[model samples]
Target: MADYSEASPPPKNRQIVLLLSFFVGLTIALFLSVDLMVGVLIGWIPPGVERQLGALIVPAFEQQAAPSSAQDTLNQLLDRLKPHLSAEQQQRDYKVLYVPDETVNALAIPGDRIILYRGLIEQAESENELMMVLGHELGHFAHRDHLRQLGRGLLMQITISSLFGDISGIQSIALSAAQTIGNSRFSQNQEYKADEMGVTLLQKIYGQVAGATDFFARLSEKKDLPIDFLTTHPNPGKRVQRLEKLIQQNGWTVGDRSPVAESLKMP
Candidate 1:
């Protein structure tokens, strides 16, 4: 009989074959896992998972967004608005965040996160205008605007990852999509809803029914970037037009009185 050891394949060749098998297995596993996660999460169109993810990332760093001084101001405003907002709406998937950057923008993330750039505070005409803006952002949360953005992003990530099958490429795609969707403009329709709701909230809280258009008007007419990547607010003119219509149609004339905030005079 031939010696069994002599008949066996060379150790070097066996090692190489084993290495190939391991890599192939690992690749398959990773592909399957990523694909499966994307499919499962997005497949049935489950409600609020989008909100959950947004919430997770938005308020992650406790002390990240604003400095202590600015935060103190925001907290005071929030305290004033607290009692009037429905408890459910009050604890929206959003938190007031302050970013020290000079960009004049405030926006909502997937969760209860609303970032107020220092530039935004500087741009405020009055405390009421600030409320109007915050109220508008809250309207987005209430209307599931951020959740819709999250859905599109989740779909985009899954698609890009599945097509590429390269982990690093998929990660990069996800990052880009995440950033884009977070900053993407709300359509005219969504903007209208926010304007209406924000106006309603403002009217209710302050009993002063001023058009929130002034905020957008300032940006729209600016020689510098009234709208740029970091400061892309919805078109002020369109938003103003819509809000004005709602006020007339809904008879949303002011007469509310809250005991909290320092009231702004309404037109």
Candidate 2:
């Protein structure tokens, strides 16, 4: 009688399967560790090194930015918010580069620069709202969210390239770093923390948190609008809820909102 016995799998096939599983597990572990490592390593990175990384990325935005009254208005707002920052953050010369593009977005890049697009300005109905937005970006700087967005891998590459004085490697890494930042998204917790910081600064500067959630509340109402800010940021509705809660929890009062300056208003 023919014996019906299950045959063992081929050794080669089993080896390949195990090897693939090993690599997959290793990849998952690395990814999970990167964020934790980045959090620890970021605090150690000096502002000077950050500027070097920014040197590679800021030029692209700088070339796109034009000097205008709008830009001047933005920097003035940033200057007003500067004193509210910690002494360490105040040491860096923070400025705004207002881009004429109507992309409806703002960015806190490596170079202590806030890239504010005209589209975002057009969305603002009040000076307080704009100041809150500016304050929000400063919060990113204070928390080093910009660097955190770059990931530990690219950060390591940049640091190593800089240390070794590898000009060519550094140049290549710069492009990667810029692309990573452009496409990256901040975590919801990070956004909430930044919002809290913005609210605190708004209260300190204007003595009330008026317009703290106005910009976000407005954006949340216009769901049909194709705003780029919504893409990289958390849902506007959620942010509005969180900010409102923060204000109430702290017993902060909401006062009148200052009107946006004519020069800064989008046509």
Candidate 3:
């Protein structure tokens, strides 16, 4: 038969190659599906719905939060910063509120709200430091991070409900996951962008970069810094170093500047 058996292909080897290729293609498709799901979770919500969601959530938050007693002084700082922002930034009515917490924290809520905690204000060594904190919150708003975060929380709730099918068993787990999502860290890129915006705000307000790194320098000394680094923010040491580099690059002086408004008291 002219060696017909030798002419046949290696069927076992061909099957193995086909099996490997199938798995590779399946892996790629799975990754693409995950990427699409993440996009929908974070950015797919409509602006109107996002605003309505914010409006609804604000009331619940207000019930739990104590208003700032230093509103008048904080308002003065807002006025000064307002006149310097671009018209686009001015278009949105940004409002600031003070929360009565002792933790050094601040939050940028949806619907043009910035929650400034008293502890953060007390931690400020200068008005510039406080201004930088305000600027960072504004940066979060300008980038729509607040809305994105809210959307993610909502999506998580939907996903958990859909996956579990039974409400009673999974309700607690779903709630816990949603809370974690709400408090989760923004990507490193977002943090750096906020830092850049804060620096730009300082330059616009004061003709230099003074006090840009002051608060971060102090923050770096805390024992909880390592824990904080793994969570929401970059390490304070890295932030200070980056700010210092920015100052040197712009040839800005790190000199003493104007203090907080007289009406405001530190601590």
* Maximum-TM-score candidate: 2
- Tens digit of lDDT per residue, candidate 3, span 67-141? 554765665676667766667678777777766666567777755667676777777767888888878877887
TM-score of each: 0.63, 0.85, 0.72
List model 1 lDDT by residue over 1-267, tens digit each.
Answer: 545476694568889999999999999999887656654545433334445345345544344574565666676675666566677776653457777766677776655667777667776766767778778788877766754555555666544544545455444444544566546776677778877777887877766676356676675677675454323555676666777777788776644333222222212
Report residue 232 deviation for candidate 1 (angstroms).
Answer: 3.5
Ranking by lDDT: 2, 3, 1
The number of the candidate with the highest lDDT is 2
Q: Give candidate 1 misplaced runs (Cα > 4 Å).
A: 1-52, 59-64, 91-93, 151-178, 229-231, 252-267
Better of 1 and 3 by TM-score: 3
Q: What TM-score quantifies how close candidate 1 is to the native fold?
A: 0.63
Q: Model 3: runs farther than 4 Å from truth?
A: 1-46, 151-182, 224-230
Name the weakest run of 10 consecutive residues (lDDT summed) in model 3: 169-178
lDDT of model 2 at position 267: 64
- State residue 135's C-alpha deviation in candidate 2, in Å: 0.7
lDDT of 1: 0.63
